[model samples]
Target chain A: MIELVLSFLKLGAVSYGGGWTIVGLIRTEVLRQGWLDEGAFRDLVAIAQVTPGPVALNAATLVGHKVGGLAGSALATLSVVTVPILASLALGALISRLGPRGNRFREALRSGTFGLLAMTVWAFAPEAARDPFAAGLALGAFGLAAFTKANPVLLILGAGALKLLASFVLA
Target chain B: MQASKPPSPLRLFLFFARISAVTLGGGYVLVPVIARGLERKGWMEEKDFFSLFGAAQSLPGPIGLNAALFAGRALAGLPGLFASALGVLVPPFAAILLVSEAIGVVAAQKQARAFLDGAFAVVPGLVAALLWRMIRTRAWNPGRVVLALAAAAAMILAPGWAPAFFFAAAALGWFVETPGTKA
Candidate 1:
């Protein structure tokens, strides 16, 4: 339990950019530590996405539960959030103190986020490419999301429904 | 109609909880959804909200959760912060717990597995769309674009050095100013 909390704490502290980047980081650490196998990790990722909240947090909760039940879930969730919450508080204070100059710092961070997100998308590409049907769905979803103002929740549901239909046909 | 009195901590908590519960695409997409809700409620002005948002982006953690913390702090102080954080976090915790418990049964069904695969596959596209939107909306420059592409390439070529990539990007960003902005 302590190890689980400590591992997630490290992840929460170091993870930047976005959830996908965090997911990548979590995947690496979990796999390295023999916490979860590749297949289990993929399922966790999928479950994290379909459910609400940050992928990292969901992953932590799920992984923690798997490892140590309810107590682990609480510990993991708390550990994952502690640094972020503290950082947010500190940053919030600093921003107010810095005033307009803070905008520059914020912009820099935003740039970093963009870069990280781009890397994350790149990392995810191979997994996405593994299945042709999934790839097609991904592209179509991208088009829909990019061009239209469709709700992502609706799009996710639609994707699930489409997949179910596809499975029936294939079966 | 704006309430003459500030919202109670419970109200703040519930509001954030609702937002977190319904939000699908994760933290990046939470901004607009939050802004819209806060605006509708007259809880925050546009300028204040964006500034908070900018700060949230600059901070660590999930942007959505960070935003909630900031907003909650702004709205009602420490109590509000606790309330909002709990509100935003609870639903996801419950949902993930429920799903994890049921995954044993769910994974066994081939159709369910396919459905999940299909849904998970679109995640990359959704992220791509987000990237495209970010580029389109932000003031872009040659240097920033190059850095982004380089970062992507680095991740592809050397997955092991992923952590270094983030640090390097931030370092690059610190030096690279936004286009048309004076140093």
Candidate 2:
């Protein structure tokens, strides 16, 4: 239990970029602790996605609920967000010395964010591409999302429907 | 939209709560909704809200949550900040908690399982798309390119200590981007 809080606290501290990067961090840590298996973890991530809110926050809440019930849910949710809230309070104003350096600093973080995001992609790829159909769905999603302004929720739902239909026909 | 008088914390809370409840796609999607809603309500202009967003990004945490915290503060100080946090957080937690129980029943269906598998499959592609956009938008020189590749390699190799590598990369970015700040 203590380990759970400690890990989230640490995870929250460096969860730069956005929800996906944070999700990768949580997935790695949760798996490391043996709290859940990969298939289970992937299911949780799916649930996290369609549900409202930040995916990482939802992931934390769900993982917490799975491991330790309601109390765990609350603690993990709050714990994961603790540093971000504090950082917002403490440093939100500081960003706007608004000088040239401020903008440059944001630029500076981009390389690392890019790296973190790269790692996130690396982590998710093989698992997402394990089967040819799955690979096709993922590639199609990439093309649609990258090239057009298609909504993600629709993409996810559409992918799910396609798979359900495929199962009916294939089976 | 003209700037109105400061909204009450409850108003801020309820406002964010509505956005939190309705917005489906997560932070990147949610943040824009908040921006627009705030603008429509005359709470903060889009430009000011986005400037705060820029600051919020530098800090850790999800962009939507951080944006809420900053926007709340900008609009109504500490009370607004806390209210916005609770607003953004509470609905989702409650909703998930309720869904968590129901998910078991839903997961039992074979069709549902197939659907979930397919939904989950596109996650990597979505993530890759996001990275592609990030890469495209950022100002990158050859030095930054080498640095980014190195950082990505190091993080992939040692993800457990990824934060350290990321911060190190950030410092290196500062060094490389800021020509002649090496006094």
Candidate 3:
């Protein structure tokens, strides 16, 4: 439990850029610590995405729940947000002082965040490659989400429904 | 309907709670909804909210959550800050707990596994799309492109050591982008 909370705390501290950026970090940490199997973790990320919050925060809470139960969930949620709240409270005034360099700082952070996203995409590539139907859905999802304004929730549910239908047909 | 006075902490709590509960699609989608809602209530103008949101983006955590904290504090001080924090957090916590509990039951069913497998499959594609957008949006200099690719390669190689690589990228970007700042 303590280790679980500790990991979230550390991840929360470096979780600059946004939720997506920190997601890859969470994946690496959880996988490295042997907390969840790959398939389970992948499912968890899917759940986290469709849920109504930050993906990273949802992932943290769910991972905590799985790893340490209800008490773990509460503590992990608190732990993940602790640093950001503290930083927000403490450095609320610092951004203004950053001047033009602030843009540079943000751009710099972007360079790192891009890598984080790349790692995430890389890590999950195998899941997309698991089957032909899965690959098609993945490509379809990328096309719609990347090129159009289709809601991701719809995409997720649509894929699930299609897969379920296929399961029934194939069975 | 203009709010003549800043919202009380409890009011702020309810306000944020309501938004967090109904808003979906994570930070990018949530932030705009919040800004519009605040505007609609006359609690904060979109301009003021977005400027504060700009500050919020500079911090870590989800932009939606951070924006709430900043807006709450700006409107109603320390009490509002904590209240807003709770508001943003509590709904999702409840929602996820319910879903996880439900999932644990259905997970044993064959259909459920297939659906979940399909749902999970889109993740890589979704993330890849996100990366594509990031790549398109950035004002990428050649040097920055090289740096980002190098950093990506390193992080992919050593996922466990991602934090170090991230910091190294940030520091290098900071230094290399502006030679005039320190000198």
Pick by DockQ: which candidate is best? 2
What range of 10 consecutive residues in model 2 chain A has the weakest lDDT sum? A95-104
lDDT of 1 by residue, A119-142 (tens): 657756678668788789889889
| CA deviation > 4 Å runs, candidate 3 | B1-3, B179-183
Residue B96 error for model 2, in Å?
A: 1.2
The local distance difference test score of model 1 is: 0.76
Q: Is candidate 1 or candidate 3 better by lDDT?
A: 3
| lDDT digits (tens) for residues B1-183 of candidate 1 | 564466678998899889888777677667788888887888887678887776666667877888888888888887888898898789999887778789979978898888777777777788788788887887777877776777767755675565667668767876776433532
Q: Score candidate 1 by TM-score against the native.
A: 0.88
Model 2 residue pairs with clashes: none
Clashing pairs in 3: none
Q: Pick by TM-score: which candidate is best?
A: 2
Give a tens-digit lDDT track for model 3, residues B1-183.
Answer: 556678899988898888888776678778888899888878899999998888788787877789899999888899999999999999999998888787777777898888888887887888788889878877777778988998899989999888888889988888767743321
The lDDT per prediction is 0.76, 0.86, 0.84
Q: Output the lDDT of residue B98, model 2.
A: 98
Separate DockQ for every predicted complex: 0.56, 0.65, 0.63
lDDT of 3 by residue, A78-108 (tens): 9999999999889877775677777777767
lDDT of 1 at B136: 88
Docking class of 3: medium
Model 2 Cα RMSD, 1 decimal: 2.2
